[model samples]
Target chain A: MSNCIDFYFDYSSPYGYLACERIEAIAAKSGCTVVWHPILLGAVFKITGQKPLTESPLRGDYAVRDFSRSAREHQLEYQHPAQFPIGAIAASRASLWLRDNSDPQLRAKTADFIHAIYRAYFSAGQDITDATVIAAVAGSLDIDSEALLLAIATQAVKDSLRIEIEQAISAGVFGSPTMIVNNEPFWGHDRLEQMERWISSGGW
Target chain B: MSNCIDFYFDYSSPYGYLACERIEAIAAKSGCTVVWHPILLGAVFKITGQKPLTESPLRGDYAVRDFSRSAREHQLEYQHPAQFPIGAIAASRASLWLRDNSDPQLRAKTADFIHAIYRAYFSAGQDITDATVIAAVAGSLDIDSEALLLAIATQAVKDSLRIEIEQAISAGVFGSPTMIVNNEPFWGHDRLEQMERWISSGGW
Candidate 1:
C-alpha cells in the first residue's frame, strides 16, 4: 500500500547522477518516497549484453556530448570524470553500509554520501574507484571515514551487493536510472517527466 | 547556408516513427527545414555493436511499454507492429527511390510516402518487411504501386541505400531519430525538446 518508487542506479552513470539530482523533488511533489538501489552496472550488463554507453562505438561520442549538454540544460554542474565508468564497488558498498545501519540519522546520511560521490565523480571529475576518495567523501559527509572503508571491504558487504545485483538483474533492470513503480519499469532519466505523470495519474 | 536539420531514421524504429510525426512541425516553427534521411539501423548497429533495442534482454520489455506510453503522452495513435524490428530493407529502399528522383513534386511525395509507411507499420501493425506492403503504403500516397515495387527491387536503389547507410555511420549517426544541426549530433526522440532549444538558441 506504499506509494514508493524503487530507483536503480550505478554510481558511474552520468544520467544516473542527473536522475539522482531530480528524482527526490519529483517524488516529494507527489508525496512518494524513493528507495535507492545502487548496484554495479557491470553485473547487469553481464545479463543484458550491453556495454557502458560511452564504450559503444559511435554512441560513445554522442553520450559524452549529451552528458555535458544535458547537465547544463538541467542547471547542474558537470565535468566529465578523468576515470569514467570507474569500478563503483566501493561506492555501492558504502551506500549499502549506510542503508543497512537502520539508524534514521545514518539513513539520511546515505543521501549525502550518494550525492557527494556523484558530485565527486561528475562535477569535480574525480576517480571514485579509489577507496581513499570514497572514504574522504564519507568523512566530509560526517560519517566515520575509516569505519566506512573497513565496512566496504568486509565479506558481508560485498556479498550483500552481489546478491542485490543478482536480484536487480532478475527483476529486469538492465540500465542505470531505471525506476520501478507498482511493478512497471521505467528506464532513463529523460523518463522522469513521464514517471511524474504516471505517479500523478496512478498510471494509464 | 540553409538552417536545415538532418534527420536520420530507420523505418522500423518506433522512436523514428514518433520523431517523423513531430520533426516537421518543430522545424516549421523554427523556420528550419528538415531533410529526412531514412537509413538501415542494422548498418549502424554493426559499427556500434548494438542490436535492436527490443532484442535486448530486460531492456526489451521496458522499451515496448515505453513506446506505447510515450506515444500516448504525445497524443499519437500507436499500435505496435506484429513484426517488430522487421527487415526494413524494402522500406528504406523505397524511401531512397522517392528521394533520388529529381522532381521537386515527387520529392514532396516522399514525406507522404514516409508517413504512410510509418503509419502502416506502427499504427496499422502491418508487416512493412513485405515489399508488397511497402508498395501498397506508397500507393496510398498516390505513388504507382507496381512501379514503386520494381523501383525498390533495383540494384541502384539497393546500392543507394547502402551508400547512405555508410554515410550516416561515418557521420556518427549510431541511432535512429538522430538530429544533426550545425554538424552536432543529437540522439533520441526524447531529445527533441533539446533539439528545439538548440535551434532556437543556435547552439550553446
Candidate 2:
C-alpha cells in the first residue's frame, strides 16, 4: 500500500512517450510518486509473442495513425520518427545509470533524462539507438555526457536494464506505458484515465 | 465521408462488449448513425496472429481483470462468465440475420440484439456460443425467437456473416470494437474518447 505508481515503458514506444508526458501530472494529482522503469520491449515481446505496433500487419498501420491522433488528443507535439521501433538500449541504460547515480541531484535527473530522450526520438526524430545521440541528449540537460556514455556501455548498467526487463515481465507487463498502482496493473496510454480514477477512488 | 460510425465487434471480446454499452450514446452525441458489423475475431485473429485476451499468457489475466474494471468504470453491470472467450459465430450470424431481415422492425433491433447478446454473455454469465442462449436473449428483447433461430441456421445468413467479416478485414479492422469514422479506423474501447473527438471535430 505504498503511494507509488510504477511506470513501465520502452523508449521506442510512441504510446510510452505519450504516457511519459502526462504520467507525472497524474501521479502528482493523486499524491503519489512515479517510479519510471525503462525496459526493453524487444525482450518483453519475446516472452509475450507480440510484435512492435508499427511492425504488426493490420495493426501496424492503425498504430501509426493512432500515434499521431493520440498525440494531438493529448495536445502534445509529436512527429513520427523515420527510424521507429529502434533499439532503445542506450536510452534505457542511460536512464538506469542516472537513477543509480550516487549524487542525489544526478539521480533526480533520471526523469528529466527520460523526457528529454523521448522527446529527442519521438519529436525531434533523433536516432536514440546510437550512444552518441543519447549522450548528446543527456548533455543537453546538463547531465555529464561522458559519464553517461561510459556508464551505459558498462556491464553493470546493461545488466541493470536486462534485470529490469525480466522483472517487468515477471510483473505481468506485456506492453508499454503500463502503470502499476497498488499492485493493480493498467496497460496502455488509454488506461491512464482509468488509472487516475483508480488512484483517486483508491480502487473501486 | 458518410455520417456513420462503422462499429466492428466480436461477441467473445470483453472490450467489444464494453464498447457495445456506450457506442450508441457516443454516436448520438455526434449526430451520427451506428452501423454495427458483427465479425468473428477468430477469423481476424488468424490474419492478425492474435490470441484471445483471456487466453494469452500475461495479457490473459490482465484482460480478465480489466474487463470488470472497464465495465465498472462505465457503470455497467458485469460478471466474468465461467465460459469465456466462447466462439461467437452463432451470435455474429444472428446479428447479421437481424440486420438483413426484410421486416423493418426486426432489422431495427440489431443494436438491441448486440447489447442483449453481450450482456447475456458478459453479465448474465450465459454461454453465448449456444444458439439457444442467443435466441433466449433475443426472445427476451421481444425479437421473434423461432424465426431468428431459423434465419441464423440458413446458409445465406452464414455466408452473409462471412462476407461481412471479409469486408471488415478489407476495411483494416483487425480487432473487436473497431470504429471507423470518416474512414479513419479507431481500435479498442479505450479509443472511444479519441474516436468521439474525431467525430466531433471531424479528425485532426
Candidate 3:
C-alpha cells in the first residue's frame, strides 16, 4: 500500500546491525523509503522453534567468524560485543520512541538513534543490555537522556515493540534483517543484493 | 592439504542443487578441485538440535520462495519437489559409489553423477529417496545403471556415506551446501560470492 520497504531487525543481532549499515543507501538508490522496525528476534525464535545462529554449535562458531569477515568485506566498523546475545529491550523501545516523536526537524533523528544503538552493540563492543547504556547513546545524540530512559519503560513504547514483533511474524518474518519490498520477504543480509535487483528491475 | 574445496551438501536441498550448478565453474576459475561430499543433513540435525529450514513455519515459506527466486536469478531450473524433504540416503550412497569407481577417465564422472542426482531431485521433481531412481539418474549420465544400483546397496558404499556424514559433522558442518576452504567454513549458497572472494584474495 505504501511505497516504503519494511526493514525488520533486532538491535542485538550482528546481521541486523550489518543490514542497518547499508539498507538506507540501498533503499534510496531505488527511490524507496526504509521503514525500520526494531523487534525482539528472541520472541520470534520461540514461535518458529528456532534459536539464534550464534547459539548453535558449528553455526555459532561460523557465524562469529563470518560476522567479522563480512564487516571487513563491506568495509564497516565492527567488533563482537563482550556481552553478546544481550537483551535488546531498551534499544528496541528507544527506537520506537524516537520514531513516534519524529517531527520535521527531527525526521532524520530516528535513523541516528537506530545507528547509535547498533554502533554501541557492534562497533564499540559495549554492553547495550542496560537501559543506562541506551540512554547514554541517546544522550550523546543531543536527545534527552533521562526522558529516553523513562520512555523506554512506558507502556506505549513496550506495546509498540510487541506489536511490531507480532506484525513481523504475521508477515512471515522469522529472522532478523528481513527486508520486505512490495510485500515479498527477503530474509537475511545476504539477500540485500537480490532485493536491490528486484527493486531496480521490478521483479525479473 | 590438496588444492581442493570441500563441498558438503545434501541431495534434498534446493540451495545445494543451485550450488552444484555453478560450483564447478567457480572452482575451476580458482584452479581448485571441488571434492563433493553428500551427507545426510538429518543426521547432522540430530547433533545440532536443528531441523530442516523448510520445517520452521515462516522460514519454510520464505525458503521455497527464495529457492525459485535464486534459481531465476542464477538462470537455473528449479522446482520444489513434490516429495518435499525426501530422504537423500540413496543419492548420497550413489555419489560415494561413483567416487570409489573413478578411474582416469572417470575422474570427472563423480561430479557428473552428483549433478544428475541434483537434477533429478530438483529440476525433474523426481523422488530421489529411492535407490532405483538414483540409479536411473546415473544411468542417464552414461554410468552403469545396474552396477551403480548394486554399488549403492553394497556395505562399502553405505559405510562410505556414513563416514562422510561423520567427517562432515566432525568438520563442523551443520547445514547443506557448506563450503570449507583452508579449514574455514562458509555455509549456504548465499556465501558463494564471499567464498569466491576469499579464494581469490587468499583471505583478507
DockQ for each numbered candidate:
0.69, 0.73, 0.78
Best by DockQ: 3
Q: Candidate 1, residues B166-185: lDDT per residue as tens digits?
A: 89988999988999988978
What lDDT score goes with residue A183 in model 2?
Answer: 86
Residue lDDT tens for model 2, A1-204:
448999999988999999999999988888999998999888877777878777777888888878888899889989999987788888888899888888998999989889999999899988988878887888888988998888878999889999999899999999998999888999999989888888888777
Candidate 1 regions exceeding 4 Å error are none
lDDT of 3 by residue, B21-67 (tens): 99989998888889989888888888789888888888888888889
Error of 1 at A38 (Å): 0.6
C-alpha lDDT score of every prediction, in listed order: 0.87, 0.87, 0.85
lDDT by residue (tens digit), candidate 3, A106-196: 4468999899889988988777887778878888888888877887788988899889899999999888899998988888888898888
Fraction of native contacts under 8 Å reproduced by each candidate? 0.69, 0.69, 0.78
Report the candidate with higher lDDT, 1 versus 2: 2
Model 2's DockQ? 0.73
RMSD, one per candidate, in order: 2.0, 1.8, 1.9
